[model samples]
Target: AGYNHDADTKAGILSACGIEAGPDDAVNLNNLDDWQEFYNAEIAS
Candidate 1:
C-alpha cells in the first residue's frame, strides 16, 4: 500500500522537515496524474 496527500499537504510536510520547494520542485501533475506515480517510479524501485 501507499500514502497520498494533496500538494498543499505535501508542502506543509516538507516545510516541517525543513525542506523548501523551489524552481526545481515543479511537478507535471497533468501528465503524471498523482503522487503514487512518482513514488512507484522514483522511490519504490
Candidate 2:
C-alpha cells in the first residue's frame, strides 16, 4: 500500500486535509518539490 503512492502524493493528500507537518519531518511526501529527495534518502538508507 505504501508503494502505491509517492511521498509527494501522500503529502498532497495531507495538505488537502489541512494537516500541519512538522519542519523536522524528513519524509515530506506532501512536498512535491522534495519528494524525490525523500525517495532517494529512503532507498539509500
Candidate 3:
C-alpha cells in the first residue's frame, strides 16, 4: 500500500501526523528486507 508513495510523501504524511523524522530516516517498511534492516539496526543500537 505504501509502495506508491515516495520518500518525501511518506515523510510529509508522518509530519502531518506529528511524527518528526530527519531526511535520512526511513519512513516506511516496504518488505521483509526493509523490516529486517530496521530490526537489525534497532537491535544494534
**Model 3 C-alpha lDDT per residue in residues 1-45, reported as the tens digit of each score:** 223556776666555444565333334423333555565689746
RMSD for each of the candidates: 9.7, 11.2, 8.2
- For model 1, how does the per-residue alpha-carbon lDDT over 1-45 read when each residue is reduced to its tens digit? 334557786665455444575222325322233455566679879
Give the TM-score comparing model 2 with the true structure, all chains together. 0.34
Instruction: Give the TM-score of each candidate.
Output: 0.36, 0.34, 0.35
What is the lDDT of every predicted structure here? 0.49, 0.51, 0.50
**Candidate achieving the largest TM-score:** 1
lDDT at 42 for candidate 1? 98
Q: Which residue window of length 10 is worst by lDDT in model 1?
A: 22-31
Query: Which stretches of candidate 1 lie above 4 Å from their native place?
Result: 21-45
Native-referenced Cα lDDT, model 1: 0.49
Cα RMSD for predicted model 1: 9.7
**Which candidate tops lDDT?**
2
Residue 29 of model 2: what lDDT?
40
After superposing candidate 2 on the true structure, give the runs of residues whose Cα lies further than 4 Å from its correct spot.
1-4, 21-45
